[model samples]
Target: MPNSTLHPLASLPNLGPRTAWFLDEIGVATEADLRRLGAVDAYRRLKFQFGRQISLNALYALAGAIENRDWRSFNEEEKAQLRAKVEG
Candidate 1:
């Protein structure tokens, strides 16, 4: 079992400790904040803070987290849209 006291962000898929830290640094400290920001916006914010050092996988992971699925769950179309939004 996991620690019940873990931050809500830790409960989401693909958001391992380091990725969670990035989100935390950006003030997305909870699942609700993640949702409110959405994957693209959250990726944008993280990118803005961390520069190009952030992984594209993290963006897909955020999309997966919002949908309560694995990052691999995203289809090509969804991934493309997300890429466009972040890269735009």
Candidate 2:
């Protein structure tokens, strides 16, 4: 029921129409919804349903959007640490 035009999740970098649709199908329809679910659960669910690895690119994008940080500005080490925290 959420429209991409008005959804903040749609504004995330690298999240195309297909990815947005996939998120919506999995009950993530808004930025707040995504934030509520958080990165770990979202990544896990995406992996479970899609059978594809959740890259740090996607995880950082989602986390940055949720935390209001600049995704691209995060250092590789910081990103790796965050990913490690989430994965474990």
Candidate 3:
């Protein structure tokens, strides 16, 4: 159970197989890449890929993944800011 043998993206918070697929499709392949891109920018990329038809839940997932926390753990203010960014 060493970090070196980890499955990379799969080991990150909030990154279920589906979410990981979306992240991969949007060009953020690794945990390092995800952190570098940050949640907001990664969310934007995913939305752009799907023509803005993506759900807000994906944004929440990304926010959580970047912070190494659960998506539902985000505060209302954080969720509100993310929602506004998505809408704008």
Pick by TM-score: which candidate is best? 1
The residue pairs that clash in candidate 3, if any, are: none
TM-score of 3: 0.78
Q: Tell me the TM-score of model 1.
A: 0.85
Question: What would the per-residue lDDT of candidate 2 be over residues 1-88, giving only the tens digit for each residue?
Answer: 3456645566776465556766777789877778789876776777677765456577777777677777788898988887797768
- Give each prediction's root-mean-square deviation over alpha carbons: 3.7, 3.1, 5.1
Better of 1 and 2 by lDDT: 1
Model 1: residues >4 Å from true position, as ranges?
1-5
lDDT for each of the candidates? 0.86, 0.71, 0.79
In candidate 1, which residue pairs get closer than 3 Å at backbone N, Cα or C atoms, i.e. clash?
A: none
Cα-based lDDT at residue 17, candidate 3: 64
Cα-lDDT of candidate 2: 0.71
Off by over 4 Å in 2: 1-8, 12-14
Error of 2 at 78 (Å): 1.9
Give per-residue CA lDDT, model 3, range 1-85, as digits (tens).
Answer: 2233334677787776666767778888898898899888888888888865578888898888777789999899999998897
